[model samples]
Target: MHKFGVWAPKAQKMSLCWREQVLAMNGPNHRGWWTLEVQEATCGDRYAFLLDDDSTPYPDPRSLRQPEGVHGLSEIYSHGGFEWHDQLWRGSPKTGAIIYELHIGTFSTEGTFDGAIPHLKYLADLGITHVEVMPVAAWAGKQGWGYDSVSLFATHEHYGGPDGFKRFVDACHATGLSVILDVVYNHFGPVGNYTGKFGPYLNENRKTPWGDAVNLDQEGSDEVRRFFVDNAIMWLKDYHCDGLRFDAVHAFLDLSAVHFMEQLSTEVERLGATVGKEFYLIAESDLNDPRVVRPREANGYGMDAQWSDDFHHALIAVLYSPKEGESGYYSDFGTIADLHKSLKHAYVYDGQYSGHRKRRHGRPTDGLSAHHFIHFDQNHDQVGNRGWGERFEHLVGTDAAKLSIGIVLLAPYTPMLFMGEEWASSTPFLYFADHEDEEMRRLVAEGRKNEFAAFGFGGDVPNPEHEKTFLDSKLKWDEQEEGNHGDFLAWTKALIKLRRSHVCFNDGDTHHLHVFSDERARTLVMEREEARVVVNFGDQPFAFALLEGEQLELASRAEVSVREGYLDVPPMTLAVLLSTSEQFENRQVEARARA
Candidate 1:
């Protein structure tokens, strides 16, 4: 026996379409919910809902499994079907974690959950504590970034559905990797979005970049808010995910007293307590507001952390200058000073005038832990949104890319790496989507070209509608062991190994963090206790003064050499130096005891 329920307040008559039968449902019963039961219905049974004498059926607004497609019937799914092998997995905390973000559709050649499972051990071996999977929610079409999702409750069928997703998560846990799923609660896809036909899920008065904003605080929006909140819980609970990374949270315009984020966070905490597992909520925000990660008791959103774009922007701008009139948000960050500020303070625009937005932006993160900021040199947005979808190494040389990465990994914050970034894969992560609508495809391709042209990016923009675009974005796993790619991979592994083995690299004490930069020489030095990172961004070699007993731990390039009182760093190189004093070693023991 199975019970079916849906929130369709305006329906004059609601009916359940289970298998070949059409059965009338119960009433809207006060809270706009209609319920029905079928004794013969069981797991795997396909179902849809009918409203007001219409013969046409619509997929469940909270569909768990869209086996056929987003436009097809919903299938009943039970979470107990899959056997999980993570009973002993206590889950790793996001603090001091090395997160690896990958799009499931592009991370593997098969583009499915099962296909991605094979690489979990590789990531775990690479010292990744969390595997941040890009959106896997059911979206329209087979190939997409999963941002334009049509069904929030269902896993993408192309990625092997809900069962496949569970297996992947279980495999990740078995391989000692926690999973962080990227979820989009800001907007729905432009196509195959039927939530409006059932209830007020979107605010018509407000508009976002995609379409109408989600009805977070409008009339008849309590249930709408519950819908998204429940969706988040479903992922953490039934899917057994360790964390969720909210996508484009800055676009969510909620004016409620207890903001949607607060409500969601509060409920998630309760759920975590009930499940007896720690679950983190990460937000991808461009606002640079520290309140996003502050505690709820402090009148904040209570998010675990947020993506700090200023760090990436400052580092990238200093390493490789963008074309004139093409800076966008990078306009305010093209100097060693900006990088220096980012190292000391997480945000360069913390309550400062910005030439990018032409206004003062960002509040200071004065009393916050640096772990609340997740820094990354490249991500899906930074790479895929490019005119040609060039990776960081493609824009700059390998040495410069390595230099930027060394700073990010050694910074006093949680660091994330985009898929294939460890090996510096040559494949481009293009912005590709497959829309069934021909006109929508054409418009997407055209809009992509115009968006880049406006940013002063020249050359041909890849047609996002082309199948080749999606295929080209898939990571070539074979290249990981080829030529310089193999060397870079080894270098990255050594960096992460050094990060884990050293006590200073794991500390998030930004107050004690000291950074010095010379704009004329294009050199920077970051000192975290006994560890020092020396970077040379200039075309010419730079000599950096070293402390007594400071030994060279690692170098991005092979041209690093030690003099009597200084270390020589070749252009576009970064070198790590460690002071192996007895006092620092004693502190390491104390730190471990406190932990």
Candidate 2:
């Protein structure tokens, strides 16, 4: 016998469309749950929910399988079928994790989960402890950015189904790498979205640029809230994912006592404790709200970490050499002081500013750990949102790439790397979508241009539906062995190694972190414990007085030197200063022994 269930509170009558036979589902069950058991219905059967005797069936909101397109029938999938591996995998700790974010579609030549398997060991060996993947939830189209995913419960059919995802996770755990899946719960994609027909899934009152805000706090929201919360848990427990990257928590319009994010975080944490594994939830919130990552005991929405966009903007405002109109947000960050404040505190705009939105933005993150902030130089959104979709390596030279990498990795906050960012791949990660709907595709293409026009971003915005747009974003792995890429790769490796070896660099302590900046000279120094990271952004060489017996641990380039209480820093370089203490020598010996 097969058990089937769905949430359709508004439906007076519901039927299961399975294998040319329709079976009626038992009514609302006092909690809006429709369930029925059938002896004939079995796993692998293509089924959907027929509401109010309508001939058209909508895909289940909690479907695990959508083998046919999102608009087609959902298939009954059986989990726990894949051969087990990584039985010893207990998950790596959250603090001091080096995360690498990559899109499965663009990361490999095959553009599938299995296609990404071979690269896991490469990242593991590269000192990456965590791999945060872009959304793989089932969405309409052969290719997409995955933010527009509608079927939150189902894995993207094009990029390997549930079984393939299992293999990928198993492979990652076996390779000593933890996997974090990025999930979008704020809004569903425009195309093939039929959730509204079944019930109140989209809210008309709450507005966003993407679409209607998910009816998280509206009436009859319990089921909608459960849908998303369950989706996150499913990824962690069912798929063996280590953590979840919540995409845009600020977009979730929830006024409930326990917000959707709060509830989700609580459940995930409970599961982690129950399973005796470390599960984390990182949010991509632009609100700069410290409450997102604050402890729940302090009456805050508990999350493990949040992406520090302020750090990216501060770095890009100066080093992003191709200073075009794409500097819409960078307008708020243009001084050495901004970079210093961003590193010292969590957000640059901590409840200050009026230029961007003509209003004060962001709260101060005073008590959060450095691990609560994830810093990065390049990411999927930052790169792909541009008209040309150029990376930091393309904007600034490779030398600047090394400098930026050092700044991000050495900072007290957790560091994340974008795919191919280590070796400076030549491919551009352009914004691309493959919606078959002509009108929807045209609107997206036109809307993208209009969105950037306000920011003065110029150039021909490529048609998102075009196959070339997606094809062009594919990483050229062969380029790693090429000219400048190889040198940059080695530089990245050395920096990561040093970060792993040094306790001060990798520690999660944020209270002791301090920063000093020279606005005129365009140099910044971040001192943590016994070590300091000094960066030079000036055209002319900049130097600072170092402590006696201070040794150079790492430098982005060879031009940086430490001599006689003077640290000579060259243009566009980074220097890590560490005193040659007995403790330092012992740690270095241990690091070399491990290496």
Candidate 3:
């Protein structure tokens, strides 16, 4: 026997379009729910819902499998059938964990879940503790960044569907790495969204840059909120994902006593306890609100961490100033002082006026652990949103890129690397999608051009509709073994190794960390327990005074040197030095005694 159900409050009548037979569903009861059981229903049965004499069928809002795409019929797939071997997998510790973010489509040539399995060991060898996969929810396209997902529960069919994703997660756990899935709950895609026909799934009165805002505080929002909360639980409990990175939390507008984020956080914590595993929730917010990562008991949103764009802006602006007209947010950066503040405070605009925003922004993040901020020089947005979608290494030479990576990896904040960033992949991760509608495709291409024009980038924006755009974004895995790419890969490995091995690098205490910088000299120094990071961003080499018994642990470039009680940091280079004060004192005594 198979049981089928749906929440259609407005439906006077409902019918299930199962393969060939149309079965009448029960009712729109008090809570706007309908249920029915078909003894003949079995696994792999394709079905959809017809409401109120509307012959057109709509995919399930909580579909577990959309084999024919978002607009197609949902298939019956049992999650319990997959044999998982991760019961023994106690997740990796959060402290000092390195996250590697990748789009499954572009990460491998085949662009499927099974195709990515071979690379698990490679990332583990590179010292990455967590593998963050981009959104996999079914969207209205052949290929996309997966941000405009329509079915929040169904895995994209092109990426090997639900069972495929389960296998990927299972492989990740077995490989000694954790999986963090990116989820979008702020808004649904512009096409193939039929939730509104069933209930108030969106707040049309309010708007977001993407489209209508999700219904969080409006009428009939209780079920909407529960819908999202249940989705989070499904990923954690059913799919076995270790964590979730909520995209654009700042866009979620809710005025309830307990914000949507707070409620979600509370439920996730409860679910984690019940599942017998620790789960993490990371938010991507432009608000720079400390309340997002603050504890729930303290009346905050209670996210475990948030992406820190301040660090990326500061590092990029200081190292290789953004191109003219391309300085949208980077206009607020471009100073060594900004970089210093990012290192010490994790937010450069904390309670300060932002010229870019034309107002004061971002409250201070005092008393928060450094790990609460995830820092990176490049990410999907930073790279894919550009005019030509140039990677950091492409804009700046090898030296500056290496120095920036060195700083991010060694900083107290948790570090994340975009796919192919470690090896300096030459491919550009341009925005690309395969929307079937001709008008939608045209609008996307036009929108991209307008965005670049606003940024003062003068050039034809790459057409996101073209298959070449998507193909070019795929990583050239073979190039990683070539000359400069090979060297950069080795450098990245060493930095990660040092980070994992050193207590100072892993410590999340921001109070214990100290930063010093010279705006004129274009230099910065970060001092931690028993270690110091010296960086020179100027056109000329910088000489910094060395402490007694200080020795170089690692250097981003070969030009870094220590001699005559001074550490020579060449332009666009960073060096980590260990302090052996005890050894220095003993050597001083021996020299004095011999004298």
Candidate 4:
């Protein structure tokens, strides 16, 4: 016999339909819970729930596997059936972690969770500690970025379904890597969403770009909050995921005094404590507020980290000029100073900005640690939203590209690499989705074209409706073995190794930045606790007056040299230096004399 339960607080009456039998359930405790037991209800059995007098069967909001897709009936799944081999695996701490963000569909040609297994070793070899997957929840169609998820609980069937994901997670853990899943709780997809048929899962009072906001603070919202919180716990507890990266917390329209984010963070922390494991929550926010990752004890939301869009925007704008004819958001950023500010401090527009939103925006992140921000040169949105979806390789030359990598990896923040970025994969991560609705498909295609016009791209944007767009985004695995691609991969690996070996590199403390020149011979020197990093962004050789006893420990071949009390750094190169042995010995002798 199997006991099934679901949260349906809005339903006056709920009945489980399985194998031609309907089992009635009772719940009025404001929990919106319904439960039923049947002998024939087993794994793989298709089921749905009948709510009130609704004739149509609604898929369970917490469906484990929708093998027939999001629009079809939910299939029962036993979480314990699979043998997990990660019994002794404890996740890596967030400090000094190298995160690689990937979309399973485009990570490999097979476009399945199983297909990505072979590349696990590649990521491991690249020194990635955590694999941050884009949203994998079941969405409307077969192909998408997984952001438009209709079934928050179910894994996408095309990506090898539930079992496939379990295997993937297990494989990752076996290789000493942790998995961080990106989850969306703000809004359902534009298609195949049936949560409303069963209850008030959306708030009409609040609206977002997607639609009505999730009912996190309205009447009957208690259960809704519980539903999402439970889902997050399920991923960590049941699926064995190490962390969750919440998508767009800025879109959460809750007005509750406690706030939905605070509630979720508190619960996740409790669950992590109970399990005796380290579970983290990362948020994707555009607010640029440090409070989101601040500790709850200080009356903050208590998220572990958030995406640093300011860092990316500042880096991209100065490095890659706005496309030929026009400029929109990228126009606001242009100087080496902007890049320097973002690298030293997480935000470029802290309490001062007008050109973008026409209003002063963003709060200062002055006291925050660098680990509170996740920095990336290119992510899914930046690449996909482009007119032709060009990667960094297409936008800049190899030298500039290496400089971008150096800035990101050596910065005092956690760094994330988009899939195929290590080797500078040529394929563009275009905006592609499998929308069965003609109107939605047309709107997406048209919107994409219009959006690129501001950037000055002349041609028509690639149609997201075409399967070829999705196919074109897949990584070319063979590139890893050839040409500049191989060189890039090697350089990235060396950088990661260097970062891991250096204690100062892992320190997220912001260093005081000193910039020598702005235009032709610019040089930035950052002094951390015991070491210093000097970077020359210009082509001509530059000199910096270092501390008397400082010596070069690591320097890029092209742009760095040390002699006497001056360090000569070449154009667009970075160098790491530490105090000389004689200096340390002299300091020790002085301390002994003082004692």
> Which prediction has the highest lDDT against the true structure?
3
| Rank by lDDT (best first) | 3, 1, 2, 4
lDDT of each: 0.90, 0.87, 0.91, 0.84
Model 2 quality (TM-score): 0.96
- Selected candidate, larger lDDT, 1 vs 3: 3
**Clash tally, candidates in order:** 0, 0, 0, 3
- For model 3, residues 1-595, the per-residue Cα lDDT tens digits are 6789889887899999886888899987788999999988888999999998788988888889999999999988888899999988868888878999999999999999999999999999999999999999999988899999999989999999988999999999999999999999999998888899899999988899899999999888999999999999999888999999999998898999889999999999998888788888899999988999999887688999999999999999987766678789889998899889999999999888999999999999978999899999999999999888999999998999999999999999999999999999999999999999999999999998999888877879789999999999999999998999999999999999989988889999878788999998888899886778899888899999987778899998897887899988888899999866576467558869999
**Could you estimate the TM-score for every candidate?**
0.97, 0.96, 0.97, 0.93
- Name the runs in model 4 displaced over 4 angstroms: 9-12, 27-30, 324-326, 511-520, 544-570, 578-595
The RMSD of every model to the true structure, in order and in angstroms, is 3.1, 4.1, 2.9, 3.0
| Error in Å for residue 263 of model 2 | 0.6
Poorly placed runs, candidate 3 (over 4 Å): 581-595
